[model samples]
Target: MNRVVVLTDSRYLGQRMPGALIEALRARDMPAVSARADRLVAEVRAEEGTAPEPVWGMRRALPALRPGDLVVPRTRNAFALSLLAQAQLRGVRTVNRWEAVQAVRDKPYAVLLLARAGVPTPRTFLADRPGALAGLPGAVWPLLLKPPYGDNGHGIVRVDSPRELERLPWSEGMVLAQQYVDVAGVDVKLYGAGERVWAVRRPSPLLAPAEEWPEPVPLPVTRELRTLALACRDVFGLDLYGVDVLPSPDGPLVVDVNDFPNYTGIAEAPDVVADLVESRLTEVVHP
Candidate 1:
């Protein structure tokens, strides 16, 4: 592939993409170009000396890609990953294939996949209706509530009991609630790239307006972390993601599986992401 076109949000078009990627492309003497959504779509001002693609919506970007080109989409939006699905339909190989990315975006669907794969995730229920909770087991006062669509722990809540459920109003889409477990302060996030797993330990970010976030436990490399990371990829079919497993008194509890986990702030830097991209590219070439 002579040209590698990376598609991502307007924010990290260049920041999160490893300088190493440019360096890696250069080492191979391949021409690589980086552009954000607006630039790629001719919406925003593209960097000087860059040619912008047609200003088409997310899905249109897929068919626009030619063979042997690389596309890295970081948006969790289904339409965003649909670009890859379009590419796949046209026989274009892309990183983190479309079907894989989409399957894990919905939390309940992801849990179902994990269950099918024999991976033990946190107890979960898919709330198909507002009153679906009436049929759910474990009618305890305190349980975890999650919206079908959530970010940064935004819609995740801990309800003390059925009393709290009464005050809440019903909405159109589905919602889910889970039995809350006693988790230690730590949340372990394992990042998988191809065959390697880079484990990072983050303290629980579950904070309220009046509370402060706690300190994180530094990551200690372990076989268990690697296994779980691989399991996440295999179960959800997502090639790139952040696997969140909370440690409980019982054992490790898999809490969240993010399609596009917060990359820039947490993953350390251009080095880590660059390494992952390069390895993926290498797999593409060698395979």
Candidate 2:
């Protein structure tokens, strides 16, 4: 029998998501294990006439993985990517694949990919220097400054003027400047796995007052949001992910694409994801 291993940080070992997934897999009589990416040790071996081969040394012993073993990466850290890449090298199957994760990790690149594929996304500009902000179309006030690689609303700021942009303790890494969409304190979160999708409307953290934050209300997945979400999955080649859309008079503008986001409001997500993993394993092992 092939093994199912979840690669993630040790902190998530007892978290709800990975724990739920592990339960689901075990319920189906499939073997499952949780491995921490931070505990991995690898080395490259080269000889006089042979190509270098990479070998992984686990801090804690794990069941030996075979070619058909399923490796599910559950974290966004760079270490997860490295581990997944090594798994690919050893012919292990991965959920969502490593290349897709690499592309979605860069916020600016993900937005550009969505726009190029005709997915409705906000107007975004990649600014390498402070002066690049001035070249944006309309160069209007209240622009959003975001780190090219960030998540969960961290390191994001709203700048009302060019002076504010100039004074931002700019760093060498690329920054993304986006036109802020007015959502009236409400935005839609859509989570997708394969063809299944679920949605919820929540108060926008940026616009909602802390004292008056509204509860997330479950929403019927609209055709527009469904179409947009599926397009994002196809464009990004993601088997499971989430999309944040801001409702606008112009239509739903996608503001963010998350890689394996927290399925907060989606009740059936864990089981569905488990099913997908099992299906993939069966296909690879049988084919």
Candidate 3:
């Protein structure tokens, strides 16, 4: 029987969404299984007059998967992506294509594509070194500086002035600088699955108040926000993802895009994601 292979880390397997998704797929008789990406090994072979073959999960080998099997990428491991790339060549389908995951994994690359696609975003700049930041054109005060790649509010700094920018120990790496939008110390987290979206209001990492706001509060998904989120999906070819939007006077500005976000505040996300997976499976079976 064809199956749904959930590619994730062991840590996430015990988490809410990944754990729930496994059960949901199996409940639907989809023959779901979890493969901890970190524990899997892959072998790629190519020879004269033959297509490339990718064999995966040597450490804890997965059951042999056929072309019709579905791979749900729940982790961003590079090794996993390499394996997925080869698996795709062999006809395995991934929920969010590996290309989309790679694109959004690089913050600057994703932001550039979003802006070119005319998505509303904060003024942004990229630099190879901290010294170059002083010369960024159209830069505003209180810029949010971030490493080229990071997540969950890590490696982010608020530079309130030129002096502040110079005060920090300059690191040797690319940095993403953006116009920080202060929305009354709140951030709008837009989580999506297929065409559906849900919004939650959480404390802004860069502008949180002294008393932490209560756990992210669910918010109504507005028409404009919905359109914006979908546009991001289109830009990145993503089906399950998250968009971080800042409600500013200029309007909601997208600050970041995530691949298969935790769906932290969306209680219905697991079922919604399962529905999307089921639909994809249907397409594969019918086609």
Candidate 4:
């Protein structure tokens, strides 16, 4: 039997996902274990201030791999994955290869990449400093101000004027200030691996009743989004990951790509953990 080791946070690894995946791997007579990547600095440095936790260890070392080694990430912290990538250079194979994850981890960076790749997305401005705002020729006013590493819209706000921009909370670091195209406040999440995919429409929690997204309502997916998602996944080098795309009058505008996005939400009515675990185990077996 081959061994699989998982690295991640103590909570999510032990109770949310990694534990169940380990069980599934074991039932197949494969050795699976969980380990945390809390000590990996190179990976965190890759994503700047972010860090990732591992959730698994797999069978054998991949190209340039060592005698007994494997890598798996349970979080979406890009900087942490950078550290893991460095370690792997010495002979370890990590899941979600760093390529794709790094591309989409930073919200602003994702916006620019998607645009350059010809994928439709909201206009974005990368503010290296307050002075950069004046040169934002393409950015519109009343823009959306987001912390470079923001998630869940926590530090997001509307900036309509230069004075407001001056009063912005971010004194250091960067931000993604992009045009705010307010539609019906609808959102979507797409999960994919190989040729299999699941697309679900989620009403923006900002407008949802009590923040409850509608049951994963299936929607019309375009080859563009799928192509873009696949490109992103390939960039992540992981076959499994979640993408969040927002809809504009023009069509779909990608908002983000979470490398280790949580499928835990599915736990509401279904065993999301088990489903994801099963899928991951299958990938390990076949890969």
Candidate 5:
């Protein structure tokens, strides 16, 4: 029987959606398991006219994964990406596909694709040095500086003025600078699970967390938001993803996108995601 393998950090498994999805899959009688991508010890061999094969683990190697199994990549560390790449090369199917995940995880590339595809997005700037951010066009003042790759609102800062931008500590590497929209402390998060797109209103990450932030309340998925969300997905051909939209005076603009996002605040997430997983497996097995 075909089984599902979720690539992620095992320690955080119980606290995240992948863990929940694993349980949900099992509950539905689908065989599932989680492999710690970060802990993986793999050796990949590449040669002419042959797909790469990865031998995993240090001591007791796990049984070789085959094309009949489905891989769901929930981790993005170098090791995880390498394993996923090898898996794809060997004909093992992955939800969202490793290529799509890699493209979308790269914030700069994803945003560029979105903008080029005519999707509304925040005005963006990229610079290798933080000090250079202060010299961007004056109109882009009050912008956000984000680490090239991160999740859960980590390492993001708002620069409201040139002086503030100038004071940013020097960090080595390319940085993403984005126009900060005033959303009145709220953001619309669009979660896509296959054919269903769910929306919720939650406190914006830019806002300081109050002693008690309001729980995210479900919102009707507007046609525009749905179309925009799917459009963003189409750019990367993502299967399971989330789109962050800011309701600004100009219009709702996509500020971020995440692959296999923790389905926070979405009540029906487990069942819906399980359905999507089963459908993908069906397509592969039948086709």
Candidate 6:
């Protein structure tokens, strides 16, 4: 029998997504397991007469996964990437394949991909040193400085002038400096799972007040947003993910692409993802 497994962070143990997926899969009589990404270990080995094999374990205890089993890595951490890559190497099916996940993790690379695909994205540059800021051409005053890899809006800074950029605590690695696109205090988040897309509009966290934060309201899935979301999914080779877009005077600009984001207000997201997972698994077993 084929099995469905979800690898995620321990902190998300009680979150809606993979938990909902587990329940849905079980309801369909499929064996499902939710394992913590941090607790999993991946080992790669090569033998003389055969291809390399990937071995997976939890707390040093090896778990047997069949050829047709499905492994979904919900965490974007290094360990999860390693585990997902090794599993795919061993012929297991995965959502948002490791290569795609790794590519999207780098904010600059993700933006480059979007631009190359003719998708609307913010003007971005990689700043290796503080002096690079002075050379940016056509740069609007209020710029956004973001660490290549961040979550929950952490490691992101807004600077209105060169003086503010100079005062930043210089770090070793390069940071992504992007032109801030004004959205009139609102941002749209589009969640994509398979062929389904869900959208919501909320006050931009960057501009919203701490105590008066407005709740996200469901927005109609317009053609433009749907097209952009689907294009992003195909370009990133993602099975499920979220895209953040900001409205501009000209059009919408994609600001961020996230893998397996928290489906905060999307009630049907888990079910949609579960259906896709089952469909993939069935294809693998039947083909």
Alpha carbon lDDT of each predicted model:
0.61, 0.79, 0.81, 0.58, 0.81, 0.78
**Model 3: residue 17 alpha-carbon error in angstroms:** 2.1
User: Residue by residue across 65-163, what tens digits does model 1's lDDT show?
Assistant: 555566666665444455556556545556677777777666778777887877766677777754557545554436778877665566677776565
lDDT of 4: 0.58
Q: Flag regions of model 1 displaced more than 4 Å.
A: 11-30, 38-64, 135-141, 170-172, 208-217, 260-276, 279-287
lDDT of 5 by residue, 1-287 (tens): 77788887764565557888998999999988778876668764555354344556644454567778788888767778778887787778889788888888788888889989999988888888678777777887888888888566667888888888656774637888888888788999999977789999989876754225576889999899999989988999998999999988888899889888877788789889999888877674554
lDDT of 6 at 285: 48
Per-residue lDDT over 1-287 for candidate 3, one digit per residue giving the tens place of the 0 to 100 score: 67788888866765576888888788877789888878876665564243444355657576656678888888877887877776687677889898999999889899889989999898888888666777655448678888887776677888877776667874638888887777887889999999999999888866554235566889999999999999999999999999999999888999889889888767788889999998887683444
Worst 10 residues of 1 by lDDT: 42-51
Clashing pairs in 6: none
lDDT for each residue of candidate 4 in 23-65, tens digit (9 for 90 to 100): 6566666656655445332212232232233223243222222
Which residue pairs collide, candidate 3? none
Where in model 2 is the C-alpha error above 4 Å? 46-59, 135-139, 205-215, 284-287
Per-residue lDDT over 218-270 for candidate 6, one digit per residue giving the tens place of the 0 to 100 score: 99999999999999999999988989889788888888888887676788777
Compute each candidate's TM-score over C-alphas.
0.77, 0.89, 0.90, 0.71, 0.90, 0.90
**Candidate 5 Cα errors over 4 Å, as ranges:** 46-60, 208-214, 284-287
How many clashing pairs per prediction, in order?
3, 0, 0, 28, 0, 0
Name the candidate, 3 or 4, with the larger TM-score value: 3
